[model samples]
Target: MADGGKVVCVTGASGYIASWIVKLLLQRGYTVRATVRDPLDAKKTEHLLALEGAKERLKLFKADLMDEGSFEQAIQGCEAVFHTASPVTFTVTDYQVELIDPAVKGTLNVLGTCTKVSSVKRVVMTSSMAAVLFPVTPLGPDYLVDESCFSDPNVCSDKKLWYVVSKTLAEDEAWRFAKENGIDLVVINPGLVLGPLLQPSLNFSVSLIADLIKDKNDTVNKNSRLVDVRDVALAHIKAYETPSANGRYIIEGPIVTINDIEKIVHEFFPELNLVDKNEASEIIPVIYKLSVEKAKSLGIEFTPTEATLRDTILSLKEKCLV
Candidate 1:
């Protein structure tokens, strides 16, 4: 009943970013069909219902990432779909089985469904900055992977690297399917997504901050580029409107460090300990930084790194998480 098929479906609606996406869409008077693996699970849906006057405008559907036809049902009559439902596990033994199949296959399934659903005009997928911002060259401390870079799965197949492999392959599958099916798809690849978490269920992407806040490491260097979740959400909506934004859009800070994030958290929450003075295991996983030039050109604004970190601390405090 929405104008121009204005219904928007967001997969993984209970997630940190997807919840905010649903909130924003509902705030703008768009009917949002939010997908959860189990819609009846009151624990998950309760918080989402409480976000930004969402109780009435938001609808819930049971759409599992691995289950086919689930997305098809959720995406019915929707003009846009924000596919952000891939697993983000930290360790994996099989890239193809654990990471690749679900990430790639899940994306393919979504695209296939999008093709069947005639009303869907666009899809703003949540790809990671990991895919396009990784270095092809081997280890170099000076590596600040730009948008032109890509993670070479052949060169690196570590367990920790499997998540990157999944994202890269998943986005590739989406583009391939989009081109073949003639569906409009825009990918938003964010680097080390940070800022206030809207949901309790955060993927490993944002879990790094939580890990660091618990002082999981002492010498871990915080040098990966970061992006605010609110900005990333805005980027999704901006890409939906911008005519020239049908390609990959990487969102990130120029130079961000979790150490800097810790400093900010310490500013407001003085009792928090995001760092420890010990020689324990502390190696920051290397990930590609983002290039927000494309997004900026489209009028997307990014929050300052310090402000984002400060807000992150505040949000965690609000949730009583830290």
Candidate 2:
């Protein structure tokens, strides 16, 4: 078990989100205990090791969400824990194994271990906007989502309904556990995360942005709000250090149609000349809009809308994805 002052632990530390969380923490002079399911998976976590802080300030450890004692070492004596590890698959055949079990169980294990660690003061859980609107309520034409809305997976009628259901249940269980344990917790619910990835190998969500740039996504979602990965990481950093911060925070960037993504990038990378015919302009359907007031209240400033789009496009280009 680790015992240190102001040490932080990040689960799934090599993942797209958690990797950035670790990067932010290490840059701030915090010792980190980064957990992966298998520390020996060199191919999976090699890029993480090359990050600026991984060698001296970061310690790689093995933890399994399915195992009770696995997360204990990572959480031991840490001041903050970021629980970002979970299964998110758009094409999982079994909801029980793919979404429900890992998300719910991983949260339980991490927070359960949080209870045992004497030094832990806060837990920043990486929840999604899906927890707010899915299966449960169909977002209205003029709906602007805030902390008050919550998705009910049981009510959703879709092939990928399990992803929404698992996130909602897991987040609900987090609050239930927090209330029962008297531990302070904060949740970050961002709408459709985008931006630079620390370990981008074409994961399910990251690949969505890649697909959009290729002019491949035809099924329209009108109101697509993309939050920069840097902004989401910054939000977590702000929440983790704020002793009095509690409850849920939405990390939304801006409201734009799907075409905005193509247009913004195409202007910079004119080689592709990405554009849509004006005929199908009304095809994009709005899903949900998340409020960023609470997160802004915590000193999390967002990038200007123009810069947000430009930076996202540049980051995607740096990866040679477009």
Q: Give the best candidate by lDDT.
A: 2
Clashing pairs in 1: none
lDDT of 2: 0.79
TM-scores vs. true structure, each candidate: 0.87, 0.90
lDDT for each residue of candidate 2 in 53-172, tens digit (9 for 90 to 100): 678888889998888879998888788999999887867777788789899988998999999898998999999987887634468767878887878766743535788778888999
Taking every candidate in turn, the Cα RMSD to the unseen true structure, in Å, is 3.5, 3.1
Clashing pairs counted in every model: 0, 3
For model 1, how does the per-residue alpha-carbon lDDT over 60-145 read when each residue is reduced to its tens digit? 88987788887877899888889888887756677678888889988888888999998888899999866864446764556655
Q: What's the CA error at residue 272 for candidate 1, in Å?
A: 5.0
